[model samples]
Target chain A: MVAFDFISHGFIQKALIGGFFIAMLCSTLGVFLVLRNLSLIGDGLSHVTFGSVAMGLLFKLYPFYIAIPIVMVSAIGIMKLKEKTRLFSDTAIGIVSSLGIASGVFISSIAGGLNIDLFSYLFGNILAINWTEVLVSFFLSLFFIFLIIIFYQELLFITFDEESAQVSGINVKKINTMLYLMTALTVVLAMKAVGVLLVTALLILPPVTALQFSMGFKGTLFISCVIGVLSVTAGIILSFFMDFPTGATIVIINFLFFVLSLLFKKIF
Target chain B: MKETENVISMQNVYFSYNSAEVLSGVSFDLKKGAFLGIVGPNGSGKTTLIRLMLGFLKPQIGDIYLFGQPAFLFKDWHRIGYLPQKTSFSDNHFPAKVKEIVALGLLSKKRSPKRIFREDLRIIDKYLDLFGIIDLKEKFIGELSGGQRQRVLLAKAMVNEPELLILDEPTTALDPETRERFFDILKEINNKKAMTIIMITHDIGTIGRYASNMLYLDKRVIFFGTFESFCNSNDMTEYFGEFAQHLICHRHDTGDIYKKSYGRI
Candidate 1:
C-alpha cells in the first residue's frame, strides 16, 4: 500500500513515463552501435555533453538546448577525423572524449568549481523531471522509432557489408551521418534519466545482455528493449522504497540483468 | 542490337593511390554475355580496376561507362551485382541469418521503406534453391563452413538476377576441390543465364578453362583478347616466354574434359 501511494505521486509518475521512453530510445540504438563496434560512442558523446553543459552553465543558458548541436557536431567530427587520418574508430573516439573532458574541467575551474546543478546533471535526478521533458522524451522516442522502422533494412545492409552496400547504391555516407546524429540526440535525452556518467550503460548493457542469448537480429532487438524497460521500471520503484540514488540504482539493476543473462546462457 | 552493346567500356583509364601509380592507360570493352577473367600478379591493380568499374573508386584520368552510363553517376545498381574479396571482418559473431543476408541482395531494387514482401521471400527461396542452400536459410551465417558461406554469398549476389556480376578473388582461400566446384557453378551461370561476368583471379592455368576472354593485367593492359587468340599470339609468347605461355595455353586445350563432362558448354 505504501509503494502504491509512492507511485501515485506526480513527479514519480513523470519519471516513470519519461524514463521508459528514454530507455527504449537508448536500447534500440544500442544494438546497432554495438554491432557496428561503436558501443563507446555513447560514452564519448556524453563526455562532450558534459563540456557543453559546463559552457551552458557559465553562460547562464539552458544546458539541454546547448548540448544538442555541440554533441551532434562532435559526433560527426569524430567520424571525419577517422576518415581523414585513417585512424581506428576507437582512437578517434578517444581523442574527442579526452578533449571534451579536459575542456569540461577547465571550464569548471573557471566557473569557480562545481555546483549542485552541475552535480545533478552529472549524477542525474530523474525523480525531479517535469512534464515538459516527459513529453519531449515521448515524442523524440517515437520519431526515432519511426526512422528506425523505415531504415531497418538499409541499416542492416550497411552493418553487414559496407562495401557491398555501397555497390548496391545505398548512400553509406548519409546512413552513417544519420546514425551518428540520432545517437547524439539519444545520448542527450538519456543523460537526463541516467546521468552523464552512467548514460553509456543504458546504451550498451541491454543489447550486450540480449546478445548473450544467441537470438536472431530481430529477436535480439526485442529482448534488449524488454530488458531496458524492465530495469528502468524496477530500478525506479526500488530506489523509491530504499532511499537510493535513482540513476545508480538503475545501472546496478542493468548490471544485475547482464549477469543473470550470462548465467542463463551457461546453464540452459 | 542488345547483344552487340558493350556492357562495360573503359578508355585510357588511369588510377593512382597517393603518389604510386597503380594502373596507367588501361583500356577495354566487354560486350554482353562475355566472361572476362582478369589475371594479374599482386599489386597489379586488378582489384583496383574492378573497384573503378563498380564506382567504388574514381579513375584519375579517363572514363568508365557501365551499362552505357558514366560509372560515377550510374544509378541502376540493381542491374549489377558484386562479390568483394572475403575478408577477416566476417567474424564468427555476426548475428545475421542466412536468409537475411540473402535478402539484402533484393534491397537494391527497392525504394524507401524497403519492405520485404512475400514475393521477395519467394525470390530469395528460388536463389537459395538454385545455390542448393535452401536448408541452411534459417541458420546464422556465422555458423556456416567456408564453402557454405561462399555459396551463400554467391546466392546473395545473384538473388536479384543482375545482368553484370563482378567478383574479386572469390576463390583465393578455398581448397582445390571447392575451387573447382565454384568454377563449375560460374561456368553454368555464364552459359545458361548468359550473364556477363568480370572475375579477378591469380590462377593463370585454370582461368583459361572458363574465361571466354583473357585479360592479363600488370599495371596496364598487357593482353586482352579471346583465349584462342591468346593461345596463338606470338607477342604473348615473347612476353610470357615459351614455357609460361604453354602452361596457360595448355589448359585451354585440356579444358575440353570439363566441357565434355558438363556437356552444355
Candidate 2:
C-alpha cells in the first residue's frame, strides 16, 4: 500500500503516465527522424490530427475515429509520394504538410464549428487526461516500442541508404510507409499530452539531446528514452510552480537540454 | 565470356532524372564471379545504372533481372550488398564504433527485440577480421582516416555475407598505395569468397589494373565486355580517342593481370 498525494488523483496519475509513454515514443522516433532530416513528418502528421479532430467536431463523431484514419492515410500517402518523386523528402513532407493544415482549417470553416476549443489540440493540457486517452497512449506507445525494436534494422538501413536498403530486399517503401503510419498514430495519441504546435518540439528536442553523446543505435535509443522521460517529468513539476501548460513546459525543458548539449559540444 | 548463369542482366534499360536522360538503351550481364568495372566521366549514368539494377529506380524502357528473377520481385537481397559513394551522411559521427556500424548489415536478418545475438556478433566479427579491420572495431568512424573509413565501408558491405557486392568508387579517396592494398583485398575476396563484384569508378589506372570485365557508360553504355575488348576496340578508339589509348597503356605494364589469373577473379 502506498500513500496517496495530490498527484495521485486518478486523472493526474493518468496524465503523467500518458505523458510519459507518449514522450518516450515520440522522442525515440523523433530523434532518428530529425537526424534523418524528416522532421516535417511530425509537423505534418500533427496537422492531420487537427484535421481529423475538426472532422469529428463537424460530423459529431468521436475525434479519434476521424483522426486515426485521416492521420494514417496522410502518413501512408506521404511515404508513397516521397518514394515516387525525385524531390527531396523534406520538400515533399513540407508540401504535404501545408496541404494538411490547409485542409484542417478549410474543414473547420466549412463546418462552421468556428468556436472549437483548438487550444486543447494546439498546446497540450495535462489537466484533460482521461481514462480513454491514457489507455490509447499506453497501447500505442507499446506498439511503437515494438515497431522500433522489430523494424529497427529496416529503419536504420532505409535512413542510411535507401538504394542499398531496397537492394537488400528490405521493402524500403513499405517500411517507410509503416514508419509514417506509426508516427501519425503516435502524434494523434500524443495530442492529449503535447497538442499540435508543440508536439514536434518534444519529438525533435529529446532525440537531438540524446544524439549529442550517444554512440550507436542502442546508445541513441537509450539516451533518447531517458531524455524524453526526464523532460516530461520536469515539465510537469515545473507546471506546478510556473502556472503554465504542461506541454509548453516540457518543450522548454527539452529546448534547454538541446542548448546544454550544444554547450557541452562547444566546451569539452 | 561464356554462357554461364548471370547474376545481373539488364536489357535495353533507360533511366532519367528530372527529365534529363541518364542511361539510354543500356544492356549488360554480370557473370557469377566477375568484377564488372563501370567507368565514366562525372555526369555519365554509372550510378544510375547501379540504382536501376538494385531496383531503387525503375527503367522506363526495359527490364532488369537479378539472380535470373525480375529484380523488383526478387527477395534474396540479403545476398547482395552495396557501398554507396557517400558512405557517411552528415549525421554519422565518429563516436559510432566500427562494430556498431558494421552490425547494421544484419538489420534485415534479425527481427528480435533483445540485443544482437551471438551468431550476429560472430558474422560481424568475421567480416571485420576478413577485412583486416578487427583492430579498428572499437574505433569511432569519425575518428578514423579516409582510408580507414573506406575499409570500414567495405566491411559493412560484406557484413551480411553478400554474394553480389556493388561498390561505387570503393577506392576513390585512398592514396595510391592504399588503393593497391584495397584492390588486393578485393582480389583475395574474389578468390576466397567467390563474390560477384559490380563497381562504378573513375580511376582508369586502378580499374584497368584490377577489373576483369568492363562496362563503360557515357550517358549511354559505350562498351561492355572483357577489359581487353573494351580497351582495345576500334570503336573505343573512335569514341574515347586519347583516353582509350591511355587505358591500353595502363594495362600494358600489367600483363601480370592477364597472366596471373588464379581462383575466381
Q: Which predicted model would earn the best TM-score?
A: 1
Which digits, one per residue and each the tens of the lDDT, describe model 1 over residues A101-172?
A: 888889989999988787788988788888988999899889988988889998988888888888887988
TM-score of chain A of each: 0.98, 0.93
How is the predicted docking of candidate 1 categorized under the CAPRI scheme? Answer: medium
Interface RMSD for candidate number 1? Answer: 1.7
For A19-118, candidate 2 gives per-residue lDDT tens digits of 8888888888886687668877888888878877877877888888888988899888777787677568777878778887787789888987455465
Clash count list over all predictions: 0, 1
For residues B1-265, could you state the per-residue lDDT of candidate 2 as single tens digits?
Answer: 2223899988988888779998889888888888888988888988887877877778888999988887766777777888988742456542357887788776655444424677787888888887678999887776777788788778888887788889988887787776777788887787788899988877665556677888778988888887767656888788779675665546535436644543122
Mark the 10 consecutive residues where model 1 chain A has the least summed lDDT: A116-125
Query: What pairs collide in candidate 1?
Result: none
iRMS per model in Å: 1.7, 3.3
Error of 2 at A124 (Å): 2.2
